[model samples]
Target: MPGFLSLRTKTTSIVALMVAVTMACGGVMIWNTYRVDRLIEGMVSDSVAAYQAAEALETALVNQKGFMSYYVMDRNPEWLQRLGEYRQLFRMRLERAQGFAGTAEERDTLASIGDAYDLYVAAKDKALGLYINGDEIAGGEAHAGVRDQFFKILDHCEAYKKAHEEELFAARQAVHARAEQLRWVTVAALVFVTGLGGVLTLMLGRQVLAPLRRLAREEAGELALMEPNEVKAVTHRIENLIRSAGEAHTELARSRENLLMAEKMVLVGKLAAGMAHSIRNPMTSVKMRLFSLNRSLPLTREQEEDFQVITREIGQVDTIVQNFLEFSRPPRLAMQLESPSTVVDRVLQLLSHRLRSYEVTVEVKREKPLPNVTCDPEQLKEAFVNFMENACKAMGGGGRIVITERVVSETDGAGLAEISFADTGCGIPEEELEQVFQPFFTTREDGTGLGLPISQRIIENHGGWIDVDSVQGKGTTFVVYLPMDSEEKK
Candidate 1:
């Protein structure tokens, strides 16, 4: 009862079963194709060809014999020439039959025929030579023996023809056997189809209509429910169930919200753990540089540079902490009218050294001048910086990032400043794209996984959204769409 399909799967299965039955019927017919019986066809063809060859051998023999008789009557060399023609014809046909002979016995038969043919030719030539020499009595006597040899050869040919005729009959019988087998196969297929159809009918009646009938009787028994449509009755039942489910859903809605809040807290806690671990590497550098500055107070230029590096690392640590807190309790954006391109330019300049360290290059493409957007430039810069950092991390060692800025006019009397960051790097997997903004999910060991989430929060806080598209091995493109101010839209 738990797994019983509620008409949707059951009905689909019935249709599929019908298709399978149709395919089975087609498969049965396919078995009846001539390709399946090619062996029988080849046998029949070879038998027919060998039989014709034997018949032709006898024909050529007959033609040769009558010509010798005519040559005896007139002593015409033309008759002997014609006789030679028929003899050659017999040899040619015999060779063709030898090629088509399908068995060892047939081969021996052809060989014997050839030997006998050779003897007949030799004897016939001797007799004809005598005739041409004008010794009629001796030539006639020799010719009589030649006729007996010709008869012997003709008998061999007739026997060979008879053997092939039997082969022809056997081939026909084989064809009949195959046809009968196919007929039985077709009968089985029909039986299966008939049985499957019956089963389908029974299932439809008992599984589908019977449930409707039972529901109808239970609901309105009197007068057999006034003969209402079964579908209408079932639909009415489903409607009631759906109404009850709606009520139940209303009861659970608040609890569902509480559960989602709890899930977010758990994710935040996970991100906190990852962030605490990630801050150490930068903080450690900050402490070491501070110790160096304390030892060498009036520091050399290089030491002063180290002090500056410590300051920047401390700032980075503060930014990370600030981003984490901002993600927990999202603050209001400081909306200011500024070109989105300016924010992009600042982020690139800020990240220029980091980009070089990662061996990544950035190419910015602007479509004229971008429209001013109502957004917190700093927050936008933070988001853009995260985007570049993510791209650098994805690139790992060496790659390129192309940042494109443009204005898009919307249908609802608004314009959008679209900043797209396209990275040539190892891309995000398709399955994990949905969770990219979820806290503490990362593809690398040192990743805090807070960067993209904080970036997404900042973008969404300013009434914008981010779209990420990636192919597995190719790369990723992150497009940020922020609506422009009313003045810009006008």
Candidate 2:
């Protein structure tokens, strides 16, 4: 009940039912016709057999009369034999008529004819014997008796034929009646099926087709009024709006974080600048005084060792101050059209000694005819160096670094040249992946954590982006997508 059929299926089923009804009607008509035909055939056959039997009896009787006259006149033995043969033929015809009888009345009439025929045969035989024995008077009396019996037998044969004819007529009437009944029934069935089919068709048209046509008309009108180019333009604008909104949301969040980080960097830069200025003046005076003291008086071994340690400590502080200042305020980029592969090759060459010392294998993969990207070669090389050094540090014992370059097309119809740095080293955790680009966020004790932030800034300034994917136990991959076309350059 829940999965009831649609109007179309119901209509089709109704039509099929009508067709089946028509076929059933046709079958009934055929069966009735066959029954009637069989009845008529049996009646006709019986009638023909009865008629033939009557005709044979009449012919035999005529032959017997001719033979009796010949035998009575000639009184010859051959004439008596011919008379006997005709008598036998008459008896055979009566027997055949009895066999052809269909009804009980007809059989009774044939039986009576058989009894009369037997008496006639016996009298004729006696008459034939008397004629042969030279008693013509008694033989004539015997022949007279045979004629009376023949008339009675003839009457019975006529009755049998009449009965068959009556039966034939009755059978014809019954066939006509059955045929008439079949005709009326077939007509009624056809009318009923046709009427039902018509009603179903009308209902289907009203319920199913009418609504479909209305919907089609409405859709056609809408389509006719709309221009293809206008529709496409609207769709394109909507898609652009959606993409812009998403990008703006992501950029806003990133901007908030970057703003906080920039403020902190600015404050650190100011503090480092002040500290360096203050510390360098005092340290320069201390170095000058030491040089003057060493030149004025001779120094012992323990005293010289103490002087060397102080100098080394002062140098380490200066190095720390310089690193902080550089991290706070990076240098300006000198942008140019440079091959990414060339920058990568230069970095690998510069780090060759360090990489070999750590037993790290470096591999660069690039297809033929690599595209040049608009970027600062020095900045890009420095970024690559920082990535490679981090990879090498992660694999303290030994590991492999693979760099692959290729051209990729963005969904916005912009072409970008992508470089991927994949290292088989300990990877960052999933939780820390998001904060990897934040300044001063590092797992390493000696790491400044400003390397990735600086690298991300450099890539963004060149109208590009950086992405990372890593599994903690497996390895890490860093992908840089830079715009290849000049229009992308700022």
| RMSD to truth, every model | 11.6, 14.7
Whole-model alpha-carbon lDDT for candidate 1? 0.81
Candidate 2, residue 175: lDDT:
83
Worst 10 residues of 2 by lDDT: 223-232
Clashes of 2: 0
Tens-digit lDDT track of model 1 for 1-490:
2346776676667668777877886887676666447857687578888888888877877877678888777777898787778888888888888988889999999899899989988988888788888888988999899889988988988899999999888888877877788788778777877877787778788888888788877864552376578767767767878999998998799688568757876766666567667875567776787877667788788877877787776776766666666666666778888888888888878988999999998989986768787889998888898889888888889999998888787788578888899999989988999889876678887566778988987888888899999987789999999987777866
Clashes of 1: 0
TM-score of each: 0.47, 0.45
Itemize residue pairs with steric clashes in candidate 1.
none
Q: Which residue pairs come into collision in candidate 2?
A: none
lDDT per residue for candidate 2 within 61-119, as digits (tens), equals: 76776577776676667877777787788878878877887778778777777777778
